[model samples]
Target: MTDQALPRVVDQATWQHELDALRVREKAATRELDAIAAQRRRLPMVALPDYTLTGADGPVRLVDLFDDRQQLITYHHMWFPDAEWQCGGCTSFTAQFTRLEFLAPYDARFVVVTQGPIGEALAYKEKVGNKMDWYSTADSPFGADMGAGPGEGFAVNVFLRDGDTVHRTWHTDGRGTEQLTHTFALVDLLPYGRQEEWQDSPPGWPKTSTYSKWPGSEDVAAAYGPQGVSA
Candidate 1:
């Protein structure tokens, strides 16, 4: 285990060959994922249930939020009223929000649903400078019906609606999994990088840090309101 006796990984020719093989595998994986995505898109539509939810503009119909867009992506942000603050992971992930604007040409709309009041939702959006559309379920039952209320967990669910019919195309509620897809996925394909310094990063790549709760962190409340922040 001494330094001199350790294997030399930095100067190995085999390493390059292994990297090449990995590149091929990555390409194949990408192709397979694209095919599966196509299948999801082709799935048949279902009737969109009647639902009303709070919006920055006021109480609004679920279908109306579609804004005539054929595809809608909703992020069920953990924005409960009594909750202290928004999820930090969500805050970080939201750095990718502006990218959603580009999807407009494809007839896709992205929105975030919060359990907080519309004013609260708006405040958070302003504080974070998020350009994506945001709505609240504070005065309505939409979040509960969508399984996005308190205790419901964090998720991003995509729905496809054709006229009055709606179909849930996909749902992802897992941690950090959102980075795997979206226009961001396309960006990650570029040579410069995805910028996420996860464990799978190649050698010498910088790793990123996850936020840690420190002493008195609970005292810091969300500026949205007295109860809007998290511990």
Candidate 2:
């Protein structure tokens, strides 16, 4: 079925009636999301050793990523030196973090960790117009310990700091990565949905396997037009 076949046009009263019914389900879903977060907060954490990573300024330890904050949020952006292209999926996820100030009130430091030189990581960051801290774990065991096992995993690992010790409280990859990208969440609400082949979209809806196709830095600078990306 196509979009025209679904969600038939309705009068004001009928629309309101259907919306009111869906509101009940929406509220229940919100509560369930809250409960899941509560359960996540209660999960056991693992102590992590201090690992070295390269930043624009220079080398820094893992604890340094906390930036004096109690919590550290890291995105495991998949990038290997041998590959010519950055992972488009990672770029799509990293693109949403351009607004670095939004997380300030939460009292946590956010960063992206990758497996390349600082310059290479910076190139990818430049392409995405990223503002959050970007780090390179080329010579570190960080990825081996916390990252996705093969094919350059896109993952997020949350750490909590207590004095001199840091513990990994949560780590997730694959579909769990959806929790970050607003694009994914917003697209899910649209009539055509994500418009990706894997999604359960309507029969005639657009579908592509290249959902993560990333553009080059110059392309982003041209497309962004201002604010974040600059030539």
Question: Which is the leading candidate under lDDT?
Answer: 2
Q: Give the TM-score of each candidate.
A: 0.71, 0.85
Model 2 TM-score on a 0 to 1 scale = 0.85
Query: What is candidate 2's lDDT per residue for 1-231, written digit by digit as tens?
Result: 544535468899999999899999999999999999999999999997877888899999888888888888898888756665577667656765667776667878889888777888787676556666788887787876887433467789999999878999998888887877787677678876765677776666667665543455445545542444342
Cα distance off (Å), candidate 2, residue 209: 4.3
lDDT of 1 by residue, 110-131 (tens): 8888787888778766665566
Computed on alpha carbons, the lDDT of every model, listed in order, comes to: 0.66, 0.76
Give the per-residue Cα lDDT of candidate 2 at 100: 78
With a 3 Å backbone cut-off (N, CA, C), the pairs that clash in candidate 2 are none
Off by over 4 Å in 1: 1-15, 180-231
**Residue 174 lDDT, candidate 1, scale 0-100:** 76
